[model samples]
Target: MLVALREWSYSRILLVAAFLSIAGCAAQLAPPYDKTVADGLNSANTEAMTLMAATSQGTDKNSFSAREDTYNALIGTLDALALSAGARPMPKNRFTDAINKVLEKRGGKPIDDDDSTPPSAHSIKKIAETLTKMRDTDKKQGVTAIEAQAFKGQLVIYFDQAITYENFLQR
Candidate 1:
């Protein structure tokens, strides 16, 4: 009888532990946005821009490849940041509208493609040139400092708000 009782107690303990483990995993699956992730994304964006600038100045194939890879990584990081910020995946039209807003702000023309090939080295070089020119203009007009600070502040606020929303949802 004592052995049976011991077995029963052990089984109950195991059951309770399993339940708690499952709950813990569920919580972690949707954990809140910590400072590390936010900072990492910001750093990645800066690094990508720097690489792009370097690639534009020379004909080094390796630099261009690195710049392209960094740019793609930045895009992924931005998307993840948006997700963590609680920006719901909008419908196709809404997503297009959001993208258009950025494009318009940058005076960029929209491309009409559904899974187009990635930009070639030549195209990347051209983009880098354009970015260099824009950077120069920003410096000349004293806009770079203002814009960079404003963007950083805006991103921080946006992420903070997102964390608030996530907290609310968790509750």
Candidate 2:
């Protein structure tokens, strides 16, 4: 009886150790950036801008619900992306500061908690060049290889969106 009990305990311990080892080795095989997030934000921004236009005029009851759903999706995607980046991707840099300024000027409030001075045109140009480089992937050179390439399109889209807002403010 004693020998049987010991053997059972050993088997249980071995099974648990194997499970833990396999769990530790498990990794995500998918791309780092989610395509769903990109699509969600794109649709959400379009819906939001349309909704804003509608509000300025008369509210469209038919579109209201759809717009609300898009807004929710956008918010959820933003939260998920932030969480995924471990809250380190976004910072008060020149490009981001410019984006915040544009948002504030258009929306009458800052979207982020940026306390630094707004970035200069020179800084913005430099950052834009960097972003352009990032977006342009050269497979032969292995530029932005692997999971990072998945983010290029989304990053470009957001950059364009911010530029549009800034231009709107200019107008």
Candidate 3:
């Protein structure tokens, strides 16, 4: 009877181990980190800060024409980064989605929207839009020191959020 009990306990342990191994292969909700994307974000953020500093200091006399190429390049970089982020595959959570929908129907705050775009992508896109608007404003009447400062602050916030989100995905 003692030998039979030992065998049964060992078998139970093996079964639990196998089950855990299978569970460990479950899907990840967020996409895997892309070093290229992170590098791009860092580089772009540096460039953006430099450009904004120059603008605020009136280095180019706040002339959009003087820095048109720079603005275009920065905007292009941000747009590319956004596209790269959006291209990554994010896993679906059907159970969570169903629960969120039910909660929403019951008047609970919605956890998320139907849009599949990642937060990093959305944040990057917002930065691009802000840059475009700044470019347009400079073209019209040149960016005032106050306006430049405000835009710089906004860009910093956006960049921080995007970079943080990308770093989170690394873990």
Give the Cα lDDT of each candidate.
0.45, 0.43, 0.86
Off by over 4 Å in 2: 1-37, 58-74, 81-171
lDDT of 1 by residue, 1-171 (tens): 999999999999999999897664422222333454446545644665564344333333323443455545555555555444333222344444666578777877755543221112122233334344434444344234445444344434544443344344343
TM-score of each: 0.27, 0.24, 0.79
- Looking at model 1, residue 71 earns an lDDT score of 46
Write one digit per residue (lDDT tens) for candidate 2, span 1-171: 999999999999999999997764544321234344345445544643443343333333444454455445544544453343232232444555566577789997656643432222222233234333332322223232332333334444554653343333232
- Judged by lDDT against the true structure, how good is candidate 2? 0.43
Task: Tell me the lDDT of candidate 1.
Answer: 0.45
Query: Where is model 3 more than 4 Å wrong at Cα?
Result: 6-24, 57-62, 95-108
Q: What is the RMSD, in Å, between candidate 1 and the native fold over all Cα? A: 15.5
Clashes of each: 0, 0, 0
The best candidate in terms of TM-score: 3
* Comparison by lDDT, 1 against 3, better one: 3
> C-alpha displacement of 154 in model 3, angstroms?
0.9
**Model 2 — which ten-residue stretch has the worst lDDT?**
117-126
**Residue clash pairs of candidate 2:** none
Between the candidate structures 1 and 2, which one is better when assessed by TM-score?
1
lDDT of 3 by residue, 1-171 (tens): 999999999999999999997765565667889899999999999999999978885433345677999999999999999999889866668744666578788986755654476788989999999999988888877777888999999999999999999988888
TM accuracy, model 3: 0.79
- Full ranking by lDDT: 3, 1, 2
